[model samples]
Target: AQSVTQLDSHVSVSEGTPVLLRCNYSSSYSPSLFWYVQHPNKGLQLLLKYTSAATLVKGINGFEAEFKKSETSFHLTKPSAHMSDAAEYFCVVSRNTDKLIFGTGTRLQVFP
Candidate 1:
């Protein structure tokens, strides 16, 4: 069984500020976790991923996340927020069969 939970449905931040989004996951098999960002009406893009090989995963657009097995969490964080960063983010988990299950969604609001 593989499941992901995005703790917040929406997060608002000021432009040029830092951004943080929380995610927790549970997996019965060895887990492969990922964070994906999607602009409005756009396809999902890979932000970062954590395979068994790496715990700290760095992703595109200055975003990063750490996989914690004990806590069953993989939270995304960034030191700065660009106006372009305002979008929907999804936390995903891969089952052993190679299929991905996505979280509901997280809407990021950036105020100028």
Candidate 2:
């Protein structure tokens, strides 16, 4: 079985500062990791994904995540934050199947 834990339930950042959302994963085998973002009244969007190809994966809106097998981490990061970036983020794990295990989610609050 595979599972993911989001270290932080909430994250805050200034409009121009960096953003980091921590996530740790556990899987029996090589798993596909993903970061999804959801804005107010909107559906979840694919931010980025890691499928055993590259360690560093880039996503939409300046977001990226690095897959670190040694650390068992796939933390999401952005160089700068935006007001529109305020939303809920999810860390997910999949075993090349249709089933997706989601984290509790982290709410990102961007301030001016």
Which candidate wins on TM-score? 2
Tens digits of per-residue lDDT for model 2, 1-112: 8899999999999999999999999998999999999998999999999999989999999999999999999999999999999999999999887699999999999999
On the 0 to 100 scale, the lDDT of residue 93 in model 2 is 98
lDDT (tens digit, per residue) of candidate 1 on 2-104? 8999999999999888898999998887789999999999999999988887788899999999988899999999999999999999999995569899999
Off by over 4 Å in 1: none
lDDT of 1 at 109: 97
Q: By lDDT, who's the top model here?
A: 2
**Model 1 Cα displacement at 87 (Å)?**
0.5
For all candidates, what are the clash counts? 0, 0
Which clashing pairs does model 2 show?
none
Judge candidate 1 against the unseen true structure and give its global Cα lDDT, from 0 to 1.
0.93
- lDDT values of the candidates? 0.93, 0.97
Scored against the true structure, residue 92 in model 1 reaches a CA lDDT of 98
lDDT, residue 13, candidate 1: 98
Candidate 2 weakest ten by summed lDDT: 94-103
